[model samples]
Structure formats: C-alpha cells, structure tokens
Target: MHEFDLIRQIDSFAADHDDVKVGIGDDAAVTSSNAYKDMISCVDTICEGIHFKRSTLHLSDIGYKALAVNLSDIAAMGGTPRYYLVSLGIPAEWDQEEILEIYRGMNDLAKRYGVILIGGDTVSAQNGLMISVTVLGEIETNRSLLRNSARVGDIVFASGTLGASRGGLDLLLSQGLTAHRTEEEKALVIVHQRPDPQVTLGELLKESGFRIALNDISDGLSSEIWELAEASNVCICLEEEKIPISADAIKLFGKQSAYEYALNGGEDFQLVGTVAKTHWPTIQSTAKEKGIRLSAIGSVEHEGDSQVFMQKNGERTRIKRTGYRHG
Candidate 1:
C-alpha cells in the first residue's frame, strides 16, 4: 500500500468536527479559532530507539506518548487542545496490525481530551518508526501562561508527584521486568511508559483568574526552574525538603538518587508554576478542592546572581544544567 493509503486507514478512525474547516486528504489542515482567544501550537516527536525501545515499550505506549507530550505543551499554556496533525515515518517492516494499534492508542487519548485528528504527512522510513505530532489549542489571551511571568516573592508550586517517570525508565533499563520486582517497581515502570498531562489543573488556574506563572516539567525540575527564572529575570530558591519525591522513585533509586531524580530527572509531565504570595492561599485552597496535589517547592527572588538554587539544612547550593537535551 502507498503512504496515502495508510494515512486514509488512520483517518478512518478520526472524528469529524465543526471546528475543522479542512481535515485529512487536503494539502494542509485548517481549524477555526475564536477571535478573543489566542491560539497555541506545539510539536513533539518520538523515535524508535531514541525516545523508546521497542523491547521495553509497547507500540501503543509510543503512540499515546506522542500525543500526550503535545498535550502537555497545551497544558503548560493553559489552553484547550482541539486538533492535531500527525506525521509518521514508518519502516516497511511494520505490519498493518501494529499501525492500527498505534492509531487506536492515540484515538483513545484524543477522545478523552476532546481533540480531533485534522491532517498530516506520512513517509517511508529507511531506519525506524517515528511519530511527530503537532497539536493546536486555544485560550483567553489574558489567561495564557508565560514562562517569563514569575515575579519576585511569588510562591513556587508543583502539581502531583515527581521523579517516578525517570526512575521508572532507569529501572526498566537496568533490571527489565522480573518476578523478583515488587508491585511498586512495576508501577514505577508504568509511569515511564505512560505519563498523564495535567490539563485540568492548568485550566483551573486559568479560570480562577489568579496572576500566576506556569511551565510543564518535561525537563527536570531543576532545569525547568532555571528556565523559568531566566525567562522571568528572577532567581528561584527551591527547598530540598519541599520538593515532592515519589515513593516509587525512592524504592527504585534510593534516597539520594530519588531526590536527584526529582530535581533533575526529566519527562515527568507535571506542572510547575508560581503564584503571587497574596494569591497563594486561595489558589492552594481551590486546588485542594479539586483533589490535585499542589506542593510548594520554593519562592522567587530578585536579589540572587544565580538563576536557581536548592536550599536545605540552612545551606544553599547552586544547581547546574541537569536534564535531557537533544544534540
């Protein structure tokens, strides 16, 4: 079958919506946007050996993650994801069944998030399977989150637990799946394989009309904090004791490494944001009502020369670059 044939097969699974002016089979997809809302778009890719190992991760998981990561981007911007374009580089060796399974995974997530598959390109790959997803979203212009909005004296907060994904990856790489491993270990591995984007939490923050700064933790917490501080022209102080470390990470990587994973390990997909000191109480209360685990990790300041630091036991240590980076 030709590339277009395969694309048509995938398109058969997509849902049609009124917002999509043009969808698959066109040269490019067109989506309608609200006049008052700003559009947000981001792209994320997953490769065969680079992003995942076929031996460790299932094809469905790879498909889910390809879309999930882009969802995380929209969440970071406090936007609603509406449409996506998926470009696939598929090797000849991949069978039709495998391809359908991948689309099924993506469709399940898309249905849950109310997103539609608009259109995309496909090509034959000489090497391995690759999926690049471009997601489009929208949010009220005034409520859009920005990396450079953290102000001095703002309280830093992290959504949900951290380090589980990184720890899970490490465990899978080192030990593989074994009968000796406990259920906690298996759960850690699942975290690495499937990450949930915090879209609801981001929407809540935007709707609440609180002045806040937001970024998703695709990179490690340390790297993300540095990015937020540098972009906002402020310094951030993270309390070591305040950082959320998951029990699974501690079980897999031990205490010290668990803390390191929380601070520097990447791909957690959690939300890290800052709120003004005065608004922290209300926002925190609302998050509690929503059953979201929002934890205060630090505070922002304008006095330091450094971008970020970890303070513990009355000692402050400057944190350097400590997350994954593409070459």
Candidate 2:
C-alpha cells in the first residue's frame, strides 16, 4: 500500500477529544489546554533488534509497548496523558495489514486512557521495523513530580512488584512464545509483552499535594535509585528485605534469582521515589484504599556524593549501575 493510503487507514484509529483542534489528518496537531495546567511531553523508541525479536513478539505487542514505555515516563511526572503521535520506520517485509494491526494495538490502549492520536510521519527503513512515540500530558501548574525534589530524611518507596518483566523476557528467550504452559509462565510473559504503567498511582500522588521525587523503574531498582539520589543530591540506603518481589516471580525464578532480577534486571516500569517521612502513613493508607501497592523500601540520608546502598544482614554494600543500558 502507498504511504498516504496507509496513513489514511491509520487515521481511522484516531479518537475525538474536545481539546484537540486538529488531529491525525493534519500537518500538525493543534490542541487547547487549561490555562492553569502545565504540559508534559515524553518520547521513546523501540527497534526491532534492540528492543524485541520478531520471532518472539507479535506486531501488536511492538505497537503496544512503544506507547506503553512513553506513558510510563508521563506517569513518573504525575501527569494525565492527553495525546500521542507515532512515527514508524517500516521495513519491506511487513504488509499493510500488519501495519494496521500495530495501529489497532495502540488504539486499544489509547481508548482505555482517553488519549488521542495526533500527527506523525512514516518512513521506509532498510534494516527492520521501528516505532517511535511522543506523548503529551498535563499536570497542574507548578505541581510536576520531579526526580530532584527528594529531600534529606525522606522515605523511599516503589509501586507494585519488580523484576517480573525481566523474568518474562528470559522465559521468552529460552522457552519461545508458545511454550508458556503454566499460569506463572504465562503471567511473566504477559508482563513482558504488556507492561501496565502506573498512571493512576501517579495522579493520586500528585493529587495528595505532597512534595515527592519520583522516577519510573524502566531500568531497574538499583539504577533508578541511583538516578533518584543523583538528581536529588542525597544518599539512599535501602533495606534488602523491603524490596517487593512478586510471589510468581519468586516461584518461577527462585528466591535468589528473584532478588537479583529485582535489583539488576530492567523494564519493570514501576514508580520509585522519595516522600516526607511523616507523610508516609497517610500516603500508604490512601494507596491501600485504592488497591495500589506502595512499599517503603528505604530512607534518604544526609547530602553527600549522590550514592545508593543496599543493607543486608547488617552489611551495607554500595550499588552500581547494573541494569539494562543501550550501547
């Protein structure tokens, strides 16, 4: 199919929103926003070889994840996602139906979040398929959650369990796509394919009006904590036992491997950050009422060389960047 025709087909997936003055069919998207609100934007790209393998992942999974990762970024800032634009690098091997399937995947998630499709460009690629997404979000003016806002003597916390995505990736590589026979295996694979961004939890934290510092756990607990410490200029000390690992992760990968995955493995997309020590109880209660898992794993110490440490059995060990990184 021709590029213009393909774009016209993809335009069928766009959603209508009152704020949007112009949508997918234009040179650029025009949208209105509340004067008291601030806009938050983030972009993420996933390539065929670096991000996933065609043999293990479906075309729709690629589309879903490309947008999901960007949503995770907006979530870290405690913003409500509004619109998104997708730029695709199409390889010759993919057909028009496959491309449309990718858009269908993106549209499914967009509808759930009330996000609309804006404008973007599509181009031909020589190597493999690539998808890049840019997401625009809104937050109350001056209320943006930031990584640099953590203060000394603050409590560090994370939402949901960690390391299941890494375990899922391992399973996919070793067992192939159809080999997930058990419930645990299937759960792991599902997490790897479709990560749930903590948008609601982020919004709740913002609504609570607490001064907090947050970073999404895209890389790993250790790496993200290091980012938080560095950005906030504080030392973070974590209790080894407090890190939350799902029972399914432990059951499949064993206790030790599960811990390793929580620390070093990446792509969990959970939020981790610091809050005032005194405010933790109320925050915890509010999150609990909403059925969200918020775990306090550590505390911020006096300002120093921004560093992170893990305490296990009375031994404190300095942590390094051991999570996933692109070369």
Candidate 3:
C-alpha cells in the first residue's frame, strides 16, 4: 500500500460525489440521505477452515470477499446498500497494518457502491479469523424483488459470465498451470478475488412491467437455479450449452472441466434474474447498458418436478450436485 492508499482509492471511486460526509481512514463513515420507504437488511459470515483455506488466499482478497458476499445478498433483493457493520475476530498473531489492509479491501468495495461502514466490534480469537458483516439497504416500500415471483412464460437470465470464479479457483489450486497463461487468467483471478455485485441490474429489474424472481449466483449455477425453481414451485428447463460461461476460463480448462466448474463450483456472485417473455428485450437492453452479459439459460414451466434440466440432441439430461456444501 502507498500514501493515502485507502483514502485515495475511495476518492477515486466516488470522487465526483458530494454526499460522502465521511469515507475511508475515518473512525466512522457518514452518508447523505437517499429516498426509501423501508429498509432491507442481510448478514453473512466467513470462518476460516469453513469458508476458505487460509493458505490459499491473501488477506486483502478475503476482506474484499467478505463484504462482497453480503452485498450480493442485498443485490439479490433489489436493494441499495446504505450501510455496513463488520465484526471481526482476529488471531493474535496478525498485526495492526494487516488489519488495516483488510479494511482497505473492504473500503475499496463499499465505497464503490456508496455503502458506508457505520459500526461494529472487533476482538481476538484463539483460532483462525472469523468475519461477520451485516449490510442494511433500502428499497421502495413494496418494490423489493422476491424469490417467489417467477411465473410461467417468464424468462430467466444471468448477468455477466458464469464459472469463471470456479475456474479461477482451479487455477489457483493447481500449480501445474503452464502455457497459454496471460491476462485472461489474471482476469479470472480478479473475478474470484473481487467479485462485482449486480446492484444496478437488480434495481432495473425491479422497475415496472417485468416478472420478478431474483437470486444471486453465488453457489454453483446448477444449485442456485434449482433453488429458484423450488422457491417459485416450477420446473426450470434450460440448455447447458446456452449458459453464458467465460470464454477465457473455458479455454483455460477444457470443455468438461469448464462445465463442471460452472455447475458445481461456487462464488460467482452474479445475479440470476427473471423477466416476462414480453420484457426480454428490455432485460437485454438494460443488461447491455450495465455491462452485464444477460443470457437466458431457461424458463419456468407450470408446477412440476422440482428440478432443472438440460436438453441435448433431443434428449434430457438431469443435473446432479447441490453446489458446494459441507456435511
């Protein structure tokens, strides 16, 4: 880190805004008012040996991911994150600068979305670090996106590409990486390190005239899609070939590897949103403007088996795996 590294980074992110009463390097942050009828709140935590392997990740990336994952929850609900509170149990071995670096990463992400850290508590743990973050956001009183709103004839779409984060994890785990290594691999590392939550796209979907079931693709796409179908009480019929996977990651890992990564691997954090058949064009247009690759992987059918399917060569293939889980 350099001089005013955190502060300058925050300024660069929101340099043009006047509503920032306080930003990075402050004991506390403050923000100006924004209109909202009710607030939505979500909290998430990542414990070492549970959420991640300490040997495999950098402290800064861990910090960024801690905030990003919670923000994904807020994004899935079509809310704007207004405030965040972080509680950390650090190991005694870590130093002050190391703690600051974690804040530095969190600051980098929170300020990007106008989220301010309001308050929290910190303490030392005897074991690995555990981070608990709660994000409070707001949506227009009755306009929040619900997981139960998907209807027949509604088209389901995902923002950005899938499986890249998973592939990136593979790349990080396998030291055998050689040849064809370039900036593309680096991009996957960035994707896994600092995921971009789709807050803006979720807001756009919450606008009038669109069918409204929404969820974030944090778990493997296969599992999350099944979750949506279960929530809405419908069948999701889609083609695996049509899912928007990262070209770079696919090239990096052959077809089967890429497909497995997309289906079972986790941590993409993109939005899996639904829109009416009539509103598909609007959905596409909105995604284009937001720089999110909106692709329709499937559609909801009238209540049937609680499953997601892939059609290939006039036959059906049932998907397995409930995403990354612990016993």
Candidate 4:
C-alpha cells in the first residue's frame, strides 16, 4: 500500500550471498568481489510507454528486461554478474500484485544467474512507472574484454542471427497479439518482450585462451562495429552476404526491411567481437561445438583512417554509426 511496505515485500525475495557484506535494508549495499580481479558496473533504466507498451508488455517481462539489459553490459566485458540493485518509480494506480510480480520476475532471473538483489529504493511517481537497475560483476583484469582492442588482422564475428527483436516490436505495435499470425511471428514478439543476455558465451570466450576484443550488439550491428573499429583504431570491412539475418525477420518484414533491421535495429543483445586470424579457427570450432551460431561477418584492417564499411557485390559502401539513442 505504502512505499516502505512495498520495499519490504520486495526485499524479502532477495537471496543471500557471502560476498555481499551488506545487502538490502542498509544505507547502501556493500559487496566485496575478487581482490585480484576487476569489478564491472553498469546501470540501465526503462520507462513505461517509451521502452514498453502496457497493452502488450507484461510486468514480468519488464522486470526481466530491466535486469537483462544490465547483465548484457557485464557480459560484453566477459564477466560474471554477481549483484544488482533495482530502483523503481511506481505510479499510484498500479495495484500491489502488479508491483510484486515485478520483483518475482527479477528474483527468478537473479536466481538463475547467481545474482543477488542487494539494495535499492522505490518512490512514488505521478505518471508512468520507471525501473532503473544497476548491476555489478567481476572479471580477471587481464581477461576483461575491451571494445577497442581489435587488431588489423583480426576477423569480425557476431553471435546469433539479428533483427528478430525489431520485427517482434513491429508486430506488437501493429497487431497486439492477434490470432492472424504465424508461429514464427509470435516467436519474434517474445524475443522483443523478453531478451536473453549472452553471459555464458562471454565466459566461454574468456576461458578459451583466445585473444579477442568484444562488445555486445545492443544498438545495432553497424553501430557496434563502428564502436569496435573506433576503439581499436582499425577499419572493419564487412561482407553484406555474411551478416546473418533471422529467417523470421525476412518472412515478417521482407528481405530489404529485414536487412535494414539487422543493420540498425536495437536491443538484439548479441555479441559482436573480433578474433585474430590465428585464433579464429579455434573460436569458430569451439562455438560450433557449443551450438552457438557464431558467424564471421567481416575483417579488421588498417585504412587511411578507422571506419566501418559494407561490401556488397563489387561496390564498397560506408556504414553509418547510427542506432537507437536515448534522449
């Protein structure tokens, strides 16, 4: 009914962890990760209507995504997510059951990932609900992946097919769960509603002894590739044919729109990274063994300047570093 009561109810769902020196019900959460390694921290926030439509998005999904997106940041650095703090701005209109369902979703996901919901604050909002999640993770200082470490001779790769999430959003906006859709179309809607962060794959890359540079594809493939190139001071040349487009996306949006979605659609939550030519074989082999769709889409090379370009047919076209940006 009230703010403190609601916080107490949510806090009861938090799991215990030894590394958490101080957890919920404290002034601030205190965590002690590995002393020898480095700690990675990331924060992400989503507001109703802007990030999700209440007409189609469930409260459980909103809670899951609020944490999943932050976990994606930890995964991009090849780290293990350990702890999280969730802050919410709850509107007065939402019933208590809806509020509890939010934490139920987050607690389930945190349990799956061994993450602890340490502490956070909940406040009243005049209008829509807002969720802000801060995630803390750890990784070996030397093994932590960097976006700018790509080398000229490295091969660029992307994990999983892209653009289905955007297609899903289109369906949700246009149809609102109507019966006149294919199974593939329904699956795309689920992808947009609930995204899976690539944490295990990131761990695999770190443990394989492969030298690499990495970043998760949150904004878009083209934009992320540009970040990798700019950070590593190398030019990336991608073969348009090599970029993996989801079959569902093609069926839903046709070839041209699907490719555009793959190139510029945001929130896919896949990894795009670079591996040296010498280590690409091992990485590719291991990824296949793990049943991960890791595809080589491009190459890193030195040009007059560092940039990203797509090669189609015989023409070379520059890729714009454009993607979804929060205002």
Candidate number of the best TM-score: 2
lDDT preference between candidates 3 and 4, better one: 4
Q: Write the per-residue lDDT of candidate 1 for residues 1-327, one digit (tens) a residue.
A: 355457667778758987654344321233456757666777778899887887666778888888888888788767888899999899988788988777777887888889999987878899999999999887875567767679889999999889998888887778764435678888878778778888888888888787777888887898778767866878898999999898878876788998888887878889899999899888888988999889999999784353798899999988896654220
Off by over 4 Å in 4: 1-35, 177-181, 324-327
- In angstroms, give how far residue 141 of model 4 lies from its true place: 2.9
Alpha carbon lDDT of each predicted model: 0.80, 0.83, 0.76, 0.81
TM-score pick, better of 1 and 2: 2
lDDT tens digits by residue: candidate 3, 188-242: 8778878888888877777644657888888878877876776677878877777
Stretches off by above 4 angstroms in model 1 are 1-34, 177-181, 303-306, 324-327
lDDT of 1 at 123: 81
Among all candidates shown, the one with the greatest lDDT: 2
Error of 2 at 284 (Å): 1.1
Candidate 2 matches the true fold with a TM-score of 0.88
Rank by lDDT, descending?
Answer: 2, 4, 1, 3
Worst lDDT window (10 residues) for model 1? 21-30
Q: Residue 313's C-alpha lDDT in candidate 3?
A: 64
Q: Mind giving the per-residue lDDT tens digits that candidate 4 earns over 15-120?
A: 7876654344321233555676666777789898787777767788889889888888778878899999999999988788988888887887788889999987
Q: What is the lDDT of residue 161 in candidate 2?
A: 95
